[model samples]
Target: ELKVEQNPLFLSMQEGKNYTIYCNYSTTSDRLYWYRQDPGKSLESLFVLLSNGAVKQEGRLMASLDTKARLSTLHITAAVHDLSATYFCAVVDAGNMLTFGGGTRLMVKP
Candidate 1:
């Protein structure tokens, strides 16, 4: 079975602070993605980490994948109020389907 879990489902993140979100999966996966969704909005792509030690980042968000360990990470730097949103990590399975993590909602106070 393939499963993914994320920590701190509701993150009351402080502004200008750094934090890391963890994703742990049950099976070996080759592809991983990080996404962000704002209130009443569709998902926005953040990063796609494809292989072991793979890392990708844009602005305040950085994501890394460890295929051997079945893990992924999303690190945030200097969080701001606008960065408050729901974050999701998804993995592509052997059949090329996506399994999404339970979303993490981050609220950053100004």
Candidate 2:
């Protein structure tokens, strides 16, 4: 069975702070993805890490993949109130479906 784990399942930060969320997977996979979800809203894709060392960044968020370690990371930079949301990392399974980690809910306060 494939399992994905994420550290710090919950986070509370003040606006302008920074943090990193770690995602670890139990199996080998070259593809990883990051997503953000607002309360009562659908998830929004943030970054797609496709290969070893693959990295993608947008605004205050960045994501990276280390296939050899079967790990991925989502980095938050200078967080703002609007950045408060639930974040998730998912690894692509052999069946081409996503196996997502337990989401990390973030609360950014001003």
C-alpha lDDT score of every prediction, in listed order: 0.90, 0.91
- Best-fitting candidate, scored by lDDT: 2
lDDT of 1 by residue, 36-87 (tens): 9999999998888877999888888888888888889899999988899999
TM-score of 1: 0.96
Q: Tell me the spans in candidate 1 whose CA falls farther than 4 Å from its real position.
A: none
Clashing pairs in 2: none
Residue 69 in candidate 1, Cα distance off native in Å: 1.6
The TM-scores, one per candidate, come to 0.96, 0.96
Q: Could you give candidate 2's per-residue lDDT for residues 1-110 as a string of tens digits?
A: 88999988999999999999999999988688888899899989888888898888899988888998998988899999999899999889888889999999999999
